[model samples]
Target: MTRCRAWLYTIICFALAGLVTGCWDGVELQRRAVVLMMAIDPAPDHPDWVVVSVQIARPQRAQPPSTGGSGSTSGGNKEDRPIAVVSREGRDVAEALQTIQLAINRVLFFGHLQALVIHEQVARRGLAAVLNPVAQSRVVRRQIWMFVSRERAEQVVNALPVLDVIPGMHFTNLFRNQIILRRQYDATIGGFRQRLVTPGVEPYLLGIDGMDPRLSAPRIVGLAVFADDRLVGWLPGDDYVGWALADSQFPRLDLTIPCPHGHGQFVVNVTRVRSRLRVMNPDAPRPKAVLHVHVHGMIEGGPCVQKEREADIQVLSRQVQQVLAKIIGQSIQKAQHLGTDVFGIGRQVYRMHPSAWHGDAAWRQTFPRLRVIVQVTTRLDYMQTYRQSALLYVDHEG
Candidate 1:
């Protein structure tokens, strides 16, 4: 009976295999519309209408870009490459997207879309209209990073060598590395919206500008500053770092400070960092915040004073603390002067003093005038030395 059952099962397995075949319903790469990146900007000569740039992968011509190289690789003459650039006009974002569909040959799909860049002109108008379509689209991935371009979206798309085929993939990788390395601004679309619509905190996007129009590919120059949904201005990369650190997004920082004793300058590499936010007098006429930051770091390279004693460590730690304190103060003052709350202090206030926030017009007026006390504590944990020692001086002859 066992032998008969085994033979019968074998026969059934073969019959099932004969009836089934893999990929019977799969769509081939050539048949589907593969989108790479998207760029949206205000239409030329008309603020009401907008232009959309769509980049698609050309799999037949080249392999995907290797780990570290320029994104666009030319498979053929620049103009002859089979890519789509569609411009559509509509009062609303959905209408414009639909119009783009009609303009393109293949059905437009955005599941693989890499980045969504907004032009400064449209971002300045406000992002409510722009975000409506993104939120409703099932094809749009939530993780797609967003940026604000100082140049028109059309220019950013067209000014490419069409190298890697998937421009969005390249752009996303660039921003992701910056975020992980804690070097650039943190303004992903999801995070930006969270900060923008979450009651009090506003949002800002990285302001991008083309490096050289004549070059084959363009690069970013600066970051865009926003107040709520309006584009306020642009901040250079270095100034933007301070804001990133204050926002708790920058995990590691290596800053150089000029020390007269060190001839050149001292390079401090921050190894460990902790920050605490305190709300003081939440219900009072004036609200205060204490940004208590404790950082542990070591001097990587600089002029040596030839001392490695406890007293020397104390003096070095105090000096580094003072430098960090001044930098944080300047950054906070600059953001306040611009009337931008990139730090989300407003949300902090709402969380701590819910009752006081009710019908509080004064908070809005006072937000630009709020006070922040920044305290920096630096500790030098290690020194590349054998024994605890002080500076050695040669004996003088009488």
Candidate 2:
């Protein structure tokens, strides 16, 4: 009898729990505006004020058919845009967002935010103040891609994406695909914050440039070097290419090696690359860092200057290694000149020799003067399809 009474009590509790489990604190999706991309720019007139622009995805509603016999719909077409951009200014990011909320009828939600873009001017000034509110906000996710735009941040945010209906999605896909296909660096807000506060290392953001001035199509160009939290300068063109080779997590790169015969360049499609950095003599006034890079690739296309002999392939490999070492050396020099440790060499030093790290202050002073040595080893394992170039045979007969 006691057991039966206990079971009845449990049943009653379960029924009451179900009654209270409905959407008590839920907002309707249609009534809320979802922010997909956000941009922060310093106000031209007032340096104290910051202009924030947001690209909000508008709800898509089906359009009714045309009244006339024409097949086209009245309200919907391929030309219709699925997003709306709004801008507001305030002393801080939070205040600016609040002002935007007051102007719009719907509540603004950042849970869907995909990208964060800052104008070059704003980035050069500093990101601490701008990123503070965003880092603290529960709605903003840490994984969003961050960029420093050469053009106004608003222009990148407002630019229409050609491939996708939503601009933010396009940007996300573009960055992710580039990392896989081109082996570019991946920079996110979370990674940036950790690097900013962590000792022995600094942070960087991908530099974006407007490809077409009229269309305002933005493209990832290079990297923006930051000393502490302030942007120092840019790593452009081949300069960035060198950095990417050293720092990429998955290094698949392309190299144009000058032919040994001095005719033209051959393309080497590097499928795999690995980099290892070692610190020597940490107690010395100037510590030395040795970076060893191992690369394995195949010759894609070039004038076939080499005979089919194994000796010829070995010689070609040595030439490729020399070129790669020179490129990596140049990249390291550029970072050293900027007085920024983009390679995280200081972090390696801290881990290997903790006694050497006095603190953040001491590491910064030592990093600029430190010596770096780059060594590259390359192997051409196979000559795809062709054993020897047709040109080699033609030249032999001549």
Candidate 3:
């Protein structure tokens, strides 16, 4: 009978322990400030100090509607604004974050951080100091999108989103669309981290600029090139598209080439672009790198040359190949002139010929002098819905 009583007591103790431990350390959702994005800028007053702006989602409060003879309703009315921007300054990013936490009643949570924006000044000065803390943080995720703002990072973060209820999500959707459209490079904290440590590759981020003085919205403008951690320069406008082609990230591109008949320009919609890089004479003092790009495309709104003959297609294809080669060559020259290896050609050499790569310094010295060749082949497979140009049909009928 004593043994049975002891067993019952043990069972009760186990149940009590389980009940006591459940949610013992979990904080209530209301007590947490969910951070959606963070922006880092160099403090204007003090050069050494950094300004950190955090965008937190504020929970909406619903008010009950009031019903009366006057027909006034108050229920379900609430402020639609979803985010609050807060800023703090300190000697470093961590200290700035600590100061920000002191101002908020709830604990700041970074697990939901969607974007990280660095001001142009901060990036120009160097990102190592600002990014080091984020890299070390346990709550921050590496997959968050990273962008360099042409204006103050705070302004970019605080801008009201036109499409998304949350400002951070606006930036997220922009990047998503950019990837789908193949308009710019898709940069993330994880990708940056990998490139930063890689021996031969340099890091780059998508550049974003405010549309107006008030920063009603932010738009991606170009690519920011980084040597080590410092912003070296930018690849603006169509120049970045060429870089994208070399990087093999270009999904589709539209180009205008001179018509074979020399009357006007025609549109070529390039798709299925494939790029390959080859390094030759790895042991040589000056090595050669060749980039070969194969593109399959169709003529979408172009005048027909040579009565739609097969020779006309070859001529058009050759013209497209020449244009692509020129663009890719120009991009490579620009990178070489800037002394930045945005193409990761050095990385290719390092992978193919590890013994040739002495160090970063050596690679940098050899990169500018390395000979690069760009070869582009374009195949015109499909013409538009009409077998011949509409103009041609009219001319034949006439």
- Backbone clashes per model, in order? 7, 0, 5
Candidate 2 stretches with Cα past 4 Å from truth are 2-8, 11-24, 61-79, 180-186, 212-216, 248-250, 304-306, 384-398
lDDT of every predicted structure (CA atoms): 0.64, 0.76, 0.75
Ranking by TM-score: 2, 3, 1
- What is candidate 3's lDDT per residue for 282-351, written digit by digit as tens? 6687678878877767787666543456666666777676666777777777777777898898898789
Off by over 4 Å in 1: 1-31, 64-76, 79-83, 159-165, 180-186, 212-223, 260-262, 304-307, 359-362, 385-398
Clashing pairs for predicted structure model 2, backbone only: none
Instruction: Write candidate 1's Cα lDDT for 8-117 as tens digits.
Output: 99999999999988889566665666777677878767767777667765556444423325544444454445455566677767878788777766676677876777
Ranking by lDDT: 2, 3, 1
Give stretches of model 3 more than 4 Å off: 1-25, 61-80, 180-186, 212-215, 258-263, 303-307, 384-398
Question: Candidate 1 overall Cα lDDT vs. reference?
Answer: 0.64
lDDT score of residue 111 within candidate 1: 75
Lowest summed-lDDT stretch of 10 residues in model 3?
389-398
lDDT of 2 by residue, 179-211 (tens): 532422237888888889877778988889875
- Worst lDDT run of 10 residues, candidate 2, spans 389-398
lDDT of candidate 3 at residue 48, scale 0 to 100: 80
lDDT of 2 at 29: 88
Worst 10 residues of 1 by lDDT: 389-398
